[model samples]
Target: MPTAISASVAPQTGAEPRSPGPVSHPAQGKTTEAGGGNPSGIYSAILSRNFPIIGVKEKTFEQLHKKCLEKKVLYLDPEFPPDETSLFYSQKFPIQFVWKRPPEICENPRFIIGGANRTDICQGDLGDCWFLAAIACLTLNERLLFRVIPHDQSFTENYAGIFHFQFWRYGDWVDVVIDDCLPTYNNQLVFTKSNHRNEFWSALLEKAYAKLHGSYEALKGGNTTEAMEDFTGGVTEFFEIKDAPRDMYKIMRKAIERGSLMGCSIDTIVPVQYETRMACGLVRGHAYSVTGLEEALFKGEKVKLVRLRNPWGQVEWNGSWSDGWKDWSFVDKDERARLQHQVTEDGEFWMSYEDFIFHFTKLEICNLTADALESDKLQTWTVSVNEGRWVRGCSAGGCRNFPDTFWTNPQYRLKLLEEDDDPDDSEVICSFLVALMQKNRRKDRKLGANLFTIGFAIYEVPKEMHGNKQHLQKDFFLYNASKARSKTYINMREVSQRFRLPPSEYVIVPSTYEPHQEGEFILRVFSEKRNLSEEAENTISVDRPVPQPGNTNWESEEQQQFRNIFKQIAGDEMEICADELKNVLNTLVKKDQDLKMQGFTLESCRSMIALMDTDGSGRLNLQEFHHLWKKIKAWQKIFKCYDTNHSGTINSYEMRNAVNDAGFHLNSQLYDIITMRYADKHMNIDFDSFICCFVRLEGMFRAFHAFDKDGDGVIKLNVLEWLQLTMYA
Candidate 1:
């Protein structure tokens, strides 16, 4: 459940008041509620009012209910224990109780039980007579019966609970709990008002009918017909009886004992004795259980006893033992054909156990149980499990988990070394190493011991300059480590092995050693451990000292030209808009001019740009351009002079002239400019360079073109003199 809640605390001073901020509360199904007056608040109010019982909003309830009402039937297979005899007996009983009379006259009427209604009871067409009979028995115990039926709440995670069902099979009872609900009329496990009641009922009946035969339509017709349909697994018909034989109760008991219903036909011998006068005639009748045969003392005396009814219920037997029977007066009927009741030739009759078995097509015992068992027809079973221990190691080859092959594996061993105290410097080294490892992993490669041979250097300075110092350190490591690691992997094995120093060796150096420049520290990696070999004796120092005045300012004309060219190419490719182009060119041109004045050549600029293009794409994208630009920004204000005509970009001609003025040959100047400018294979300038060049050239062209008024590309002496005076003024 997702819910939102606010985390803000009330202000202590009680100054006027601040607006409530968003609050996030977990649970309640990711629901968010706003304070006072927000969309969520309003929704919450509406939900609280309309669907109080559901715990969810009215809209949500509506949606869920709508889904439940759709036509769908859920079939479940429950595993019934093989030992459940009592349940088996209970399942033998008939599902329908047929009465000769309508429901109103019956002393006790059968009603739907467990599920929502009789119409909802669906029997999967399996030969599980026991399960079906159990279902019928459960109907007698409605509430207790329903308790075993799984409900929707049972499926919910937090509020779920198990329910048990018991069934009597043979003589004993068996019980089982199921996880899900019995399907409703709509075939869903839940009920809703919108479901079609008639359809549900029809579906249930169809289910039962299908179990008897292959189809449900065959079971339709009359009461006895329906009962017989179920009994013989076919369709059947039933008739009403006005009266029955005197021994109905005895016959009923006997039939119950014998475990089957009896069938017969009836006929009237004489109809005058009937209390309710009506036509009496021969008719077929069915009965169950025979009490005793009435043996008269006299040889010719009429014999009569008792018989019971199996209501698929009817009024009574309309033959010899019927209420209108004249035979009570001892009248003789040699004409057995005239009897009120006639035995159906193939109709059922009570018989001794032996005869019952011989005559009836089928017989089954009905057993009742105190509990019911799960009726799911499907069952699932489980199979197997296994377990153990493992050890792991690291090496250039790869890490491996070992079970049997352990000690001899060099790949799994760890190497350790002691180093002098330099906590900050060590931290920097460790961080750099971690970063390198990450890069290796990203490339789906192993961080081999040899790869660690690459050298690293960390420098520290005063806290006041920490930010700048850290930036420089990061930039240097990122640029150099990437190249060096690749080189180490491809070249020196011994150097790589020695480079695999432990993280602790990179410890920060103490400020005490260099107290005046307190907090200053530096970390350096050796190609080999000290005192290891002759070559290892040589120490190469790459110092990242605090920037000071005397170091060679690498920002020379060549370097500046290289950087400017890369910047133009990178910026153009980046497609930076007009205003940005102006700023970038202004900055780069100014730096280039300054570097030129300082005697830096175009070669130096080219070298710097080459260093910056990490991917070796020969051109810099915006990120690389900006990085290179920052490095040269401090050297000169070349941007001002580059925008000669007061526009933003320097065109080829303008660029050539600018470099020439700075003492660069045309070819060298062009080389610097083109190399710095990002372009496609066709050599077309990119958007960033184009905009910058366009603006810068526009200005330069305006100044120069104005002087060459004749449009001959040359400025006469008079024009130059006039232009100088006007520009000066």
Candidate 2:
């Protein structure tokens, strides 16, 4: 009965989203699913050229470790250098820090002492308690803990200065490598630390995380859900404890039983910052993990109790339910042992469920299912992840507000193969959640870039458009209504919504609410049942190439003009070099004031010359020149028809038809590549670009036919011939 909220919802009224964290897989009997099979799935990416790494080469642990072992030297990470820059970005330095290894802090250093537990993590001077809480929760599930911290690693073996940790970044798991140099002040760990002085896993893990997000200062403060997702890759749902349903305790019991990661915290409202440290021994803004739930026998009655652990070691809740409170004297030893009640200030304590809701303002539960709407569903979700980009004018077709380019956004096909199985069997629908996340805004701190307003719209695919591999175009979107969409568009890192609809094929268009904002994005769709995913299907079949010479005919006067230009540019033998061809086309293109442009580039003319340079003279002759002139005239007419406003550049929407008009057949795939290549960031195709694209295509097609001896694609090209083809193309 809790008001379930996705990560997208903005903070308001009773509750707001904290950062999400990863959940443990249900495979270890920690969390059980209705079906034993691993139902979660990931969609392969297309057009996933990620943010450039710039100059630094990527490093891997296996390779770096082997190299260090061979050389018998400590591995120093060149990327995240140990310097003050790695400690602070813009925040004022709170202390002069010294960097040290675990051995320097304690003689008998340990990667992990005995076993990992909530007691292992303790907050340092840095305000990253949220991360500490997640680490505490991570210890409860070994399956998830081993993933974030590879268990194979140790201090005794492979004792290199290098270490690595895995974090779920966007839709993929990335291994962040770092050096073992821990920042210290007065010889103590400066950020997140371990309770055992000699223990170093948590400290090194924090360094890897900081390196992943740019610097340690960047990890100053965040929500538990964020760390939970990074650690467990789980779907997180948040609840305002104040607005929680009557069965909130039941929900928690079920979630934890099913391997869901749990974390909570007292409200961190800025206005009440001074009151954060309460008299009852709870920090107002501190984050804590829900490690266990039990019913304590008090006054011969069962009172719901939740076990909480503070990220700061040695802090205990001191209310009536506090350790050694006189009320515990009444409970028998067996019942007390069953509840695991310990009398110590080990940062772990029990608070009555009533007192829990009164003090803890919020709770976050991350699952391995599409339980965004109904968080307690006992199901395994099938997830599909795809990476995409929204280049201005190209793929950044804004929301439906800009109908002209809306279809230009990346399209994904969602095929609901079957409906969810229901005992009642009254309704037939597929339940899925679509989450669209724009990447890298958090790292652009220097540029001051904020999250863009992004969302996705789902439209039922028409019967005819079901199986084609073409992208849906402007016309299709203009005529069809979106079957479902994000609940609302908001400027958050991620915006997601849950939907239950009739089982059918649908097209999901993910885009920024405003057009022309350039950025990379990842799209994720989680379904309770199998959902087949692919790039959006085409709105229609490809139109055949336009007939040669098109429908336009040249008049006697036009032919005379063409001959006059060719003869002047060439000679009696009718030979003209690329420079001459450039001049001739520039002159011809300027003839019509309505079709006026800056004129074709010399490079473009060279391409046109090469297209018909059969003898490889790198020049055009009378016959070839005549053939090219006729084609140019016909193509110019097509451009004029599509450039309705005579803007000299046609909108991307008109590109396909214009290409077809110019006698080049194009399917949706090629058309998509063309737009990404030739169209400017604004998505406009000028005459020069239009001509150049086709010229290259024609040249490549011709080259393929000539080299493909038997008409099959297989070819044996010598180095020189391959160079010639590549250079010319």
TM-score, prediction 1:
0.17
Model 1, span 1-729: residue lDDT tens: 111122121211001011232421100000000111112222332223221211222324234333444533222212321122212222343332221211122233222222333223332322221222223322322332333222222222322212223321112222333222222322331211112222222223223232222222222111121122122211111111223235543443443332222232222122232112223321221112121223222236434343322211123334444544445355344423233234432111222232222222212122111122122231211101111011111001111111111111111011123332456564422112111111111011112111111111222223354222111222222233221121111110011111234332221111110011101111112221121101000121122226667744445775557456545644546533323433445555554332222222333333443445555555445666555555444212343455545433343323333333333222222333442453333333322443333223323444556577887767655777667434422
Query: What is the C-alpha lDDT profile of model 2 across 1-729, one tens digit per residue?
Result: 001122221121112223331211010001111111111321112112132232137645777788899999987778788788788777667667888877777787888777666777777777677777788777766556766676656778878877777777786677777778888888888777777888888889888888887777666545576677777666666566778889999999987777678887665535345225778887765667788888777778888888887777666789877786778878878888887778877788888888888887768786754322123445778988877887665567788888877887788888988798877768887888887877876566436555676778899988887776567777888788888987556555666667899988898898887787878888888887889887653342223355666434445886778678978878776899988988888877687788968888988988898898888898888778877876787778888888888888998756866766665665445666788889986678999998888788777777877897896667789999999997876
Question: What is the C-alpha local distance difference test score of each model?
Answer: 0.26, 0.71
Instruction: Report backbone clashes per prediction.
Output: 123, 19
Regions more than 4 Å wrong, model 1: 1-203, 208-316, 319-363, 373-729
RMSD of 2: 7.2
Query: Model 2, residue 120: what's the lDDT?
Result: 71
User: Which stretches in model 2 have alpha-carbon errors above 4 Å?
Assistant: 1-72, 91-95, 156-158, 170-174, 238-248, 265-286, 314-334, 343-346, 352-362, 369-379, 440-450, 537-556, 651-684, 708-718
